[model samples]
Target: MSSTETATLSVPGANLSYTVRGSGPVLLLIHGGNGDANVYAGIAEHLAERYTVVTYDRRGYSRSKLDNAAKEYSLETHSEDIHRLLTELTCEPAYVFGSSAGAIIGLELACHYPGQIHTLIAHEPPLTHLLSGDEQVHARHIQENLEITAQREGIVPAIRQFATLLGLDQSNGSSGRPNVEQLERLLANMNYFVMREAPAIRRHTLDLETLKTVWNGASMRIVIGGGRASYGTFPYQCAVALARQLGLEIVEFPGNHLGYVHQSQEFAMRLHIALQD
Candidate 1:
């Protein structure tokens, strides 16, 4: 049997909209930056079979709106939103699976509120703390691209830079697939979609200062690098560093950065295994 339901969660005056699919234990699927929880549509629907998949748009995006009179958005607020959503559900400890920036937010959730998560599968989180010289360079490169977008405010170069950071640069001869067209389409849509609400994500990030404040307090699974080729990439390094800091084992899932997109089937399979484990 397959099904989907939409609902609104009232948190501190904000009416947060979310969707639920499937049954069994709850698993909150959080999306990364430049995306809504819709990005997990492919996997969430399937995972719903064995899990109560929860996906929602971050406040200030899509259907969710903020009740608090905060002008700016921060990861701290985002983390609290998740906390309130879970609390309202009477589900204090649900398994959480997040990717990229969403993974960073999940980490924040665990830190901000302890024992609030059963298991968290952080797939290729760009935690940045584990970044080395080359990884730092790539990060700066992507940030530069974003700065360019903020300056010229055009999303094309930024899109290309995104592909580059995800190791999709044509110069690298990474893949035979055609991504330029897809990237172009993504940029065209963003102006009306994600880019329109830039302030929601403006200037916010996961840094050592923030992590140190919460890492020791929160119990979490710090997932990191696995593949032979991914030895020194940002995510892998982040996994290593986070595991060391948290004294947790590095759990390997699937892809490098955008595993859910690049290796969807394998990514989903690994994610399933991770959650099950």
Candidate 2:
């Protein structure tokens, strides 16, 4: 196994903690939901064998300490942090993989700072802005309900509701044991995610015009991806909608939303194939 090197960057409102391993073109992994850099540990380890895998805890999550805990989280700030990290870490443009909310952030980065990215694989970005009429209203209601639940009940119940809304709580009878440490870390970050990140994500609107400009110019290659089993879910639908709008192909990965966690090696292999020369 390649040794992991940890570092910190003093960004605007937070000191970001990140990890780097292996060596090749820089491939930065942006985690989603109640997660930190550790969420990509398995995928990073596999990808590191061929590429320099970089993973970081977004502002106010895990090891990334925030200067203002009460500061409202926004997609702009999240995207800016990624741009700063890439600019400080590499002279050349980097490949980026962003999951869920992280995927939304990647889209923002590609739209605003096209020069900083080579290719971006945005996996299941929950782009509610792409929806229309009834679907949009339905999505809004779900998010609003989640916020209310978190405020009234707590993070755990809110998360359970979230999973149920996405239909992820259904039993598949898979026998793998959960990682206790990862679960604890995820639980610890739930407060930040539920109170701040989720709201930010819900309010964000992707600039389709800017995205079209970048894609038309071929300045940045954007690939939409989703889990095969996650079809019909909001995130999967969002990926499909975005791909349809952009006239791009939607790449299917191994498992559901958390595929990279349980099927990391398989996901890594498919990811490498999708990113091949």
Candidate 3:
């Protein structure tokens, strides 16, 4: 097993809680909505064998505290936080793997600081704008409904709906089930996630024109990944559309949307291969 170390970094508006394991080139894992670093537990353990794996609670999630009153945040803000984190950890460019909304953040990061990343594996970024006319409209409608559900029915009901939206409701939770403590933490985080993070994700637009310029000029490689089990879903469609836009192939991985949580070992191995490529 790899060794583990946890620490906190104070960024401008928040103190970010992060964990490091193993030793090698850095591989930062950015989790999606309602999840903290704990979501990557199994995946980190496996990846740490070959890389210094960094998992962190994004600004308002888990132990990472906001220093002031809650305010609307943007994808660019999260990207800058990560930029500071990468600069603090290593002088060399690092690899990044981001799931769902985290993947959107990674895309934002790559756009602004292309030189800071060696390669970025963006797995299932749910950018509705990437979809076609009706598809995009329908996706946004679902996101709008999710927000309304969160506001009217509270976090639990909204989360249940979100799970269904992401195809996570189909999970038996056999491998992905959180323990009591983790469950409690996740539930707590969902409040901020539903109210703040989800909207940030929804509002973000992938500047494809800018991204093309970056991709053509930078050394950074962006790989889009989609889950095999998640095929035909909203997120998977977004992944496909993103790949099509970027002229990159969509790398299929094990399990569903939350594959890193449920199929961690296999996902890590596939990820290792993707990173090497």
Candidate 4:
């Protein structure tokens, strides 16, 4: 029988709703765009057999609500929240798995609070700053345009544009569509994600010097991951660039960007292998 528990944590500016399942070593899962704790439902279920999986709705998303909804979000604040949660949950270091924007958060945490994470698998972190010249300029342009669209036309249109810009609109190898219920939940959080989180992601820059210093210390293992079908996408390119910077190899996961959602079983199995390696 599967065991589960839910709880709330008071963070800097938000109240986070999180779930814990099964038992063993700690494994923290951070959701990406238009997602909450439930995003890892399938993968968590499988991993929970040997890992105490922890999943949470990030600040200002779903059940995790901000004290000041109008407050601007930043990767620093998000990483701090994760630190606080880990402090409260256990003294031992934990494994972390993050996708997209959440992967960015993991990078921040690894940079700032290295001792808290044992191994961090950051899948498809959209580090636009890794790009160069015209590519960097083009990526920023899209982000700025998306922010403007979200503010002017609203989230629905902004989301469509985001999909098209990321090439997620393509039917082949497209991240499978969310079910109607999941889509509803995503739509509900679109405003927060597009208007708040997306802008934060675009503006944030990684501190390579600090990252290198930490990596040299060998305090924790950092892995960059990309999906097989996510080639040609900005996030995948970003992952590739980051791996080159760190002199690390890119770990390929199953499916596309949202493989953890669409191919949870395979993703879970692959994740286990990745974590071991």
lDDT, model 2, position 20: 95
User: TM-score: which is higher, 2 or 3?
Assistant: 3
Per model, how many backbone clashes are there?
0, 0, 0, 0
Tell me the lDDT of candidate 1: 0.64
Residue pairs in candidate 1 whose N, alpha carbon or C atoms collide under 3 angstroms: none
Where does candidate 4 stray beyond 4 Å? 169-185
Expressed as tens digits, the lDDT of each residue in 157-180 for candidate 2 is: 988888888867432222365478
lDDT per residue (tens digit) for residues 1-277 in model 4 = 4699999999878899999999998999998875688769889999999899999999888788889987768888999999999999989989999999999999899999999989999999999999987777877888888889888998889878977887663221224687787666677778788877887888789999998898788668999999998887888889999999999999999988888877889999999888888
Residue 18, candidate 1: Cα error in Å is 1.0
Decreasing lDDT order of the candidates: 3, 4, 2, 1
lDDT of each: 0.64, 0.86, 0.89, 0.87
* Candidate 1: stretches off by over 4 Å: 12-14, 66-70, 132-134, 168-232
Candidate 3 Cα outliers beyond 4 Å, as residue runs: 169-184
lDDT of model 1 at residue 83?
A: 94
TM-score winner between candidates 1 and 2 = 2
Model 3 per-residue lDDT tens digits across residues 1-277: 9999999999989999999999999999998884788879999999999999999999888799888746667778899999999999999989999999899999999999998899999999999988988878878888888899988988888788878876784332235577997677777788888888888788888999988899889998899999999997889999999999989889999989998888889999999999998
